[model samples]
Target: MQVTESGADLLALLRELDDPQWLEWPTSYDRSAVAARFGELVARLEGDFGVPCVAEQDTQDSSEYGRATVPAEATVCGTRIVVCVSKFGSLALVCAENPGAYLGTQDAQEEGELDDADLASVERALVELGFTVVPEELVESDYDGPSRAHLYGQRPTWWDRFFGTF
Candidate 1:
């Protein structure tokens, strides 16, 4: 969803999706697993970029639980960036113009000298680490989130939506 989306928009979307039971906290959600993945991701990022990794979580948000948004940040190519990650395995790289500006729930906010090639390398690292990195062009120019309709003649599941896998 867009960073500009309102709370009402989120509610509408959830209701439209029939209030997916899996979204309920402590149901299908595994907090420990999510946290562990975050740690691993941070380590991977640090190694890939040759920089220290720092992460910020969302445990204080009252309206947020069961969901993941472990954004790990670091400096690469002399530019600070935040790698937004989620439990669903979606990731986005944001130039760290503002601290904590990027999260797994929203689009990226960027303001650095990270050229396309640099961003591509970052995406490659994420993909190598087994995270689904959406093409920046599609996300920046044509993102509509995931479709519930038969995308490419197949009904989309959460797996397909986030991981590009069946």
Candidate 2:
């Protein structure tokens, strides 16, 4: 069956079934496994629909989940669908302008430098995909324990104290 860009229909289809019933979830499903799953899904979708579906894996460490973007083609609707599947069966699909657009927005958001237009576009895309996109002000609220652990080691003790003050 071919999947269309109608958010409601897509959501219904996804909610009606489970992926685990068809594919085995690896115990140690790391980034590689996620990428492989993305590739597999794209291949299946393309074969079933007989269209060109390009799948690209986002390997950035800061992302909450691994991402795969499939562009729309002649047979498919003009939608750029981003699939993010967690190791535990949880999956989210965010439809945006395109992979390049979404990634650019993400990069700006991560850097806390997103312009108003870009931010609006991102919000619109997320909302269209039925997601409650968090505001930038509230995005970094949860900071505790290992979740906030600095990937890079601390500078000087003085710099550490001055870090948040700025």
Candidate 3:
């Protein structure tokens, strides 16, 4: 009916990290479908965790005109969890208590990025909700083929390697 200690633990971990970190749902599904699941999660956050959750359209050109967008983030126990859906429907995650952006690897480890416990709790909660957590970037084989840059023999920067990757 509502979230559990695991959810609160995740919120604590998010607060402790204080820097952006990444999480991935291995399975790619339509954003509309996932948004429903997100709604359930938001309900749990408010009903069980006592956190005020918010949902809003991302307002990014990359986002769809009027569908497939949700709050994409929330803060609980003083930490924040940000959820982002790709144009192609994959879910990418980042959490922080402070204001900034992290791309999973650009920042050094000394900055208090999320620890394993933090990742585990959030990942466990997601797994219970029917999503497989991928640790990092999806392999090239996960896609249909090499990207346009690779296909055309143009070497794109490592940062530009993946499609819909932030």
Candidate 4:
């Protein structure tokens, strides 16, 4: 794949995207990174990782009905998972209770509950794929860090934090 940004730069951009105050579609820098790595990521997802998934590249804003993805899916073993790959290279892997129904993979891997070994192998692959991987501990966690503070022009209620992870 054509990598447009250094991993360090990508990481910084990812941190920028992580800002609760930041909103809007990914910047060109972020999009460039995603566009460059998308192919290799999908390959690993469908190949080495044994997870069959695709990205929704048409999302123009964060509020679209199908914001998948921005990037996520595949089944690992018996568990149905959604993998969200951000434009800046941060990756989130989460468990899905419903098949083909969106589990809101947006920026909330903490809610992701997966087998430890399984998640490890996946994170390893992601690291190899040049992604800024999130910590495994963050998955299946009760993280109350700074999250998306608002959507549209209105502030979200307490239940709406981090894309309504409930």
User: Deviation in angstroms for 58 in model 4?
Assistant: 3.7
* Tens digit per residue, CA lDDT, model 4, 1-166: 2224554564444445554644434233455555556556656656654545555453444411111211123433344444445433244333333212433333223454344454555555567777654422232234233653343324443113222321
Candidates 1 and 2, the one with greater TM-score: 1
Name the runs in model 4 displaced over 4 angstroms: 1-22, 26-30, 63-77, 89-91, 96-113, 135-149, 152-166
Q: What TM-score would each prediction reach against the true structure? A: 0.46, 0.35, 0.43, 0.49
TM-score of decoy 4:
0.49
Encode model 2's per-residue lDDT on 1-166: one tens digit a residue: 1122454453343333323232223244466755665556556545544566655445333233444454444223344444443333334333344333434434544544334443343344434444433222222223222222342334312111111221
lDDT of 4 at 61: 45
Per-residue lDDT over 1-166 for candidate 3, one digit per residue giving the tens place of the 0 to 100 score: 1223353353343233222222112234355675676665455445433446554433243321111111224322223544332323222333433213443411311355544444444545555665423223221123222343332234332112222333
Off by over 4 Å in 2: 1-28, 64-66, 75-77, 86-90, 98-166
Top-TM-score structure, candidate number: 4
CA RMSD of each candidate after superposition: 11.1, 13.0, 11.4, 8.5
In model 1, what lDDT does residue 95 have?
40
lDDT of each: 0.41, 0.38, 0.35, 0.41
Q: List pairs with backbone clashes in candidate 1.
A: none
Question: What TM-score would candidate 3 get against the native?
Answer: 0.43
When summed lDDT is taken over every stretch of 10 residues in candidate 3, the lowest stretch is 63-72
